[model samples]
Target chain A: MTERTMTKADLVTSILLIVFSAAVFLISASMPTMAEQNRNPLAAPGIVPGFIGVVLFLLGLAMLIRSVRRGAPAFFAQDRGKPSEVDRSSWGRIALTVGLCLLYALLLGRVWFPLLTFLFVFVFVTAFEYDRKAPAAGQWKVPLFAAILAACTAASVYLVFQYLFLVNLP
Target chain B: MFEGLQLFGQAIVSTFTLRALFDALWSTQLGIIIGMLPGLTATMGVALLTTLTFHMAPNNAILILICMYIGAIYGGSRSAILLNIPGTPANAATTVDGYPLALQGKAGKAIGIATTGSFLGSIIGMLAMVVFTPLIGSVALSFQSFEFVWFSIFGIIICGNLTAPKDPLKGWIAGFLGLFVAMIGMEGIHAYVRFSFGSTNLSGGISLIPAMVGAFGFAEIISVMRVERYEVVKTKIDRVFPKLSEVFRYWKTIIRSGIIGTFIGAIPGVGEDIAAWVSYDVAKRGAKPEEREKFGKGSIEGLLASETGNNACVPGAIIPVLTLAIPGSAPAAVLLGAMLIHGVRPGPLIMIEFPTFIYEVVAMVLLATFMMFILGLSMVRPLVKVLQVPRQKLMPVIFILCVVGSFALQARLFDVGVMMVFGILGYTLREMDYPMAPLVLGIILGDILDKNLRRALILSDGNLAPFFTRPICLALFLLTMFIVLSRAKWFRALLAKIFRKNATA
Candidate 1:
């Protein structure tokens, strides 16, 4: 099948880039043009960023033109006639994973690292286990095996990084 | 040259200890495992290893890091061949012919060929490093602000051009974005905070290791998770070594790719991924029509070119780091940082100051390549099993590792947060087809570019003429412009017309 024309995502990404470039340009402009430490205006902290801003703006404009010429669809419109399996489930998976990561990050330094890691891995594996093909034995075996594997992973990582390598863990 | 040889001999002696040998073997094995797993890359492998090796002796630590870097780059071909999912970006070209070979039930032979290609490519690169580094170091001594500025720009431009073949503009954009990201901290010239907005954390700027982990590691995890299921190929194993005749037949391709890979690797800020692609493209272009049909369909020559080019790049990427204090790739940048941390400075005066260090690095690379070859051939069966691990189970572990890696760099939770932010950003950018190589290179090169440009201008007393007038500067400027503009439709069309006319005559 032929690829779809520019989708709404392309247009949105281009516009976001344009806005980002403009923001960088403004921030660069606000930096000290001539510093007391150096007499040359060319040595200003803002010079390179200013140039990068201009390049980014031009690039964003190019992207905008290309996306427009290719016929951008609406923001919420689907790219294909029917949504595929990934299209239907990817968002939920992403959100759930992100949420798990957020919790892990929050708990990283507060609790014992190995313990926190074990819990995080356990939850993550359990959540993803349902999606895998079932073993021939029984449904209960999946979570039990996942928990054991998660514990081993966490303990191994802790031992390797903390004891062997002496990397101070958070 | 005599001094270099003396130092090389000393380096070989230093690395002969049982402890050193064990470090090299263990690190290389770990590197290969990381490289064979989907969602992990050579850059991340080196970065993570750097933190862990902080306490070892400089020689041992550096040996392990070098081994890991080489092994990881070589190891990536396994998954690329077996599952069509490149363990690292550098292996993407391998997937073209390698996966096809696996589908034809020659996976063992493909892996064996890849191993030989990596060994020969690395041998060539190591030889080049030994011979050319002193010469480059001497030449680089004269490189001033103008040359450095142009060099950094040239790196970014060429990298963007190579990575995003279809749309270089997007590549350039991603690169500049990375430069902007680098600008969000205290300026080196005056120590004046530019974009910190009074936040103490922002003043130190974003950490490179964390940002890189986010871009390549976490970003990969997110991308891999987005795909629900991937097609897996099953194949029977035969011999794990290619015939001597097969190796001899492809000697020309291997040598050509080695030369190309080393040359590209010597260029600052470029990496193995581009080397592989460029070598593959050149090989494809030069192939006879009948032989060309075998390309992308299990051609041994195509796989050899790609594997050789990328493997050679590991040592090529080290040339600038040792001679010029400039990194040839993202991993090289991290290696540069690690060297500084280990109190070994790599620059023009390295021969004068730390004369034996370069030779030590050369020895390390040589040892690493041998280890990689041995491990690659022997561990082929077990390593291929990594491809069978379900992505669902593998990704979360990868994600947790990303978290630990980012935090382990400086013991900063904020860096972990930075990784998360970049992970989301990288995922979005990847979805939109923007390449990540230039972005990472831009970040790595930003400070060098910024400092050199201003320094050149200041030295010239606000005159911009020297930037374009100096011989090296002029050449670099023209080369960068040529590479950037050569991708334009008009330029290609015009070149095509000229070539067609010449053919007709």
Candidate 2:
């Protein structure tokens, strides 16, 4: 969003972050406080982070106040509509890709990693391809070539590291 | 100097052996390819390769890692020039003038200029590595753990200040955020958990490579995908190569950018990306009015400035890595990890413990730069032609490489998840005008700050005075504070008013 496009949304988000962070700090801060009262401060669950959390909370508070007062559009430039913009509609696809990757990691030992890795590469890359022009053979060819290369590379890596190098890999 | 020369000769002899130097050179070319490909990055290239080097000689392993570092940094310009999308963060500066030149149908010429710039810059950076490393070592030996603590903090602060000058507060905020992230999972000093929040993966803190890939690569891709049009440039095929006269005309720019790149490289914790941006900006500002107009519009001067500056930064970044065990850039950090794996600790004792290790590093960087120069220049014209390829088609190919790059990091799907999360985070932050560089600086240097800060405190017996009193520490502290404050409205207004009063008086 450009400065002209920026609404009250940013301020709301900043306030929410500040509040949530403070609450979390309070909970964590209690852990160290309880430990200190027990005379076992050394055994505190999160003393250092508790301290850090307090600072982070304060910074968030500052940002919250700053954003609300200045109004984001004045303080920060509106989003320049570059080709690199990411919005909400694409979250599901992103999530699906992440899910595929996690599946690959979880099944690494049981499944053939090379094949799955290929699928992951092929599907993700192809899914993001935006060329809507007439079918170009070479354009599709890059993915095919990449898939083949990835599969072959994965196999070589697996063979080298697994059998020859004798290292465990997920 | 004679001793240095002898050592350089000895290194030249030792580094050139078939298995040692050639491998380093060959592998560097592969690194360039990895970086040139839009979806792959130098960090991932190095990480994936480190596993392969696990059984190699430590020297060989380090050489390979550095080669990849050199290659990747140089390679990113290919994408930035050809596609208007930087292949690596380091190449982001290149895109400012590079893509514009391509659109003007001077893609080949632009690529050629960029190639020359990168080559000369890398050579300059390498020369800096060869010359100043020992000097840095001689002086750095005086430092103890306490000094390192301040140094680390200074590095983070300087990187933040330079990187996000538009919002110094945000830069520090992001830097501290990264440090806090490093604090997650486990604290380096004690057996205490800092911010795991109860997840097992959280306990491990964050994996540096995955985080880097996510933020730089995945986020960049997601942001790109969300855009309605990725085809930002369309240009006809043209020849690529800077003319001899063009080189002679900008001799000063090349020299200045190379020098800037080298010095920045020598600084601990800072990296090539920032060096490139700073150099480009300086060169643009340095140029005469007529020349400056050509800046974002794609003057060969701007392209050369950025390319030379960033490539030169490669060697500059290496100087601190070899001498002081501190990396100037993120890839160098990975290279440091590889060094540890290879049983080589690159600190003051390196000269005594492993004689000519510095020489070997120098020779390796020089050879890698040459290889990167040759290979990078050759790919320019061909790559520029790829810009004509439509977005729908190009995007698919990029997607494949993304998958390959992600899986290559660990062959585990888990890394993919890390990449996705970071990618989304990067995209969102980017969408929100939050600079990504500070986050990178944070993650890359987080461990350094955590470890050194505590060590400094321990060494000083919990005395914080040294952080202020030490000469280098004091300068860095003040600089950091100054940069932070300069971003405030009051500071700007005060400066303006003071200047006005001075002019009137």
Pick the DockQ winner. Answer: 1
Residue A123, candidate 1: alpha-carbon lDDT = 86
Least well predicted 10-residue stretch by lDDT in candidate 2 chain B: B391-400
- Per-model fnat list: 0.71, 0.16
lDDT of 1 by residue, B287-349 (tens): 878879999999999999999999999899999999877778778877887898789988888
Residue B153 displacement in candidate 1 (angstroms): 1.4
DockQ list for all candidates: 0.59, 0.23
Off by over 4 Å in 2: A4-51, A72-115, A118-169, B103-105, B197-205, B227-241, B267-270, B296-298, B323-325, B347-355, B379-424, B455-462, B496-505
How far out, in Å, is residue B404 in model 2?
8.9
Candidate 1 ranges beyond 4 A from true positions: A1-7, A34-39, A73-86, A131-137, A159-168, B230-232, B287-290, B489-505
Error of 1 at B148 (Å): 1.1
How well is each residue in B282-335 modelled by candidate 2, as lDDT tens digits? 999999899998899988888889989988988787777777776777677667
Please provide TM-scores computed only on chain A for all of the candidate models, following their numbering: 0.80, 0.60
